[model samples]
Target: MLPVGAGAIGTQARTADSPVMRMLDELNHPATAAHILAERTMLHMLRGHCNSPIAGYADTTPDGRMSLFGMVFKRDGSAFVRSHAWGDPSDPATLGSRVAADLLHQGAMKLIDATRK
Candidate 1:
């Protein structure tokens, strides 16, 4: 299995409007686009770069609710904070931001800081 933060880099590249995003757009995958957008929004809100020990995932239910899960960990993997939030799917950013806020409230930044060194 991949490490906790493995899914983050690809999303960061896509967020940079790289060729991968172009390919996904050309493939006409709106759902995929939306999902990635929400997940990336969480990463952005948390100030998480690909190299950070931070991981996030977001998804929307068929009924239009968006849910986001985020985690931050120390470099040694000795501690971590995780949080989740849900909201209207159409406003994915709100859901993502809320989850990030929750993580912050749980002291995620401390873990992130520990990882940076």
Candidate 2:
């Protein structure tokens, strides 16, 4: 499946004033943008991109806590490391940064570097 294209469509689907966007907003589901921000922040800290073998996901609980997961993989898919963290939903950037730190401490950066050799 075209995850990238699908992501683009999902982004557009959340645009303000659209019917879907309005419904989501009314339903308190506007957290998609927040999740994106958290994931992007984590990726930035890891120096990863959409084309990289790095992945992350973030979400908030009804209690207002944000959880994030980050993973980095070797090019041949032989090795990887992943980490998870939680923080205040209003400060998702911190949640992401912490998760990235955990992954790095787990030697995720080493695996990523190995892939370049």
Candidate 3:
């Protein structure tokens, strides 16, 4: 079987005041968090859902910059739009937004809309 993509694991607490949550948060790796958050933010900006033909990945470069790559594909896999960008690791959301906007500007929405029908 082919691999669809990578998955992210996260933890939540009933309340923000929980000491266990704080500890877990502290143990979080900044680079990994940035990568995941950046990808998630791109998907969010694109309004991507489980049914949408959207894919995205984010990672940190060896020099510590954050890079995001995103794509929107037609349902039949006949066409697609893609965008990539690199930005500061400390501001991953901006990188995500930038790449998403690039894809949108390139008619990603058309591909996304076609998938719904």
Computed on alpha carbons, the lDDT of every model, listed in order, comes to: 0.69, 0.70, 0.80
Clashing pairs in 2: none
Model 1 TM: 0.72
- Segments in model 1 whose C-alpha atoms lie over 4 Å from true places: 1-26
Q: Count the backbone clashes (under 3 Å) in each candidate.
A: 0, 0, 0
Candidate 3 stretches greater than 4 Å from native: 1-5
Candidate 1, pairs of clashing residues: none
User: In terms of lDDT, which candidate is stronger, 1 or 2?
Assistant: 2
Q: For each candidate, what TM-score against the reference?
A: 0.72, 0.69, 0.86
TM-score of 2: 0.69
In order of TM-score, best first, we have 3, 1, 2
- How well is each residue in 35-59 modelled by candidate 1, as lDDT tens digits? 5676667677777765678877766
How do the residues 1-117 of candidate 2 rate in per-residue lDDT, one tens digit apiece? 111112522434646668887665565544666677777777777776455678777768777888777778877878778887778877777877888888888887777666555
**Global lDDT for candidate 3?**
0.80
* Per-residue accuracy of model 3 over 1-117 as CA lDDT, tens digit each: 111136666777777678887888887777878887788788888877677888888888899888888888888888888888999999988998999899999998888777667
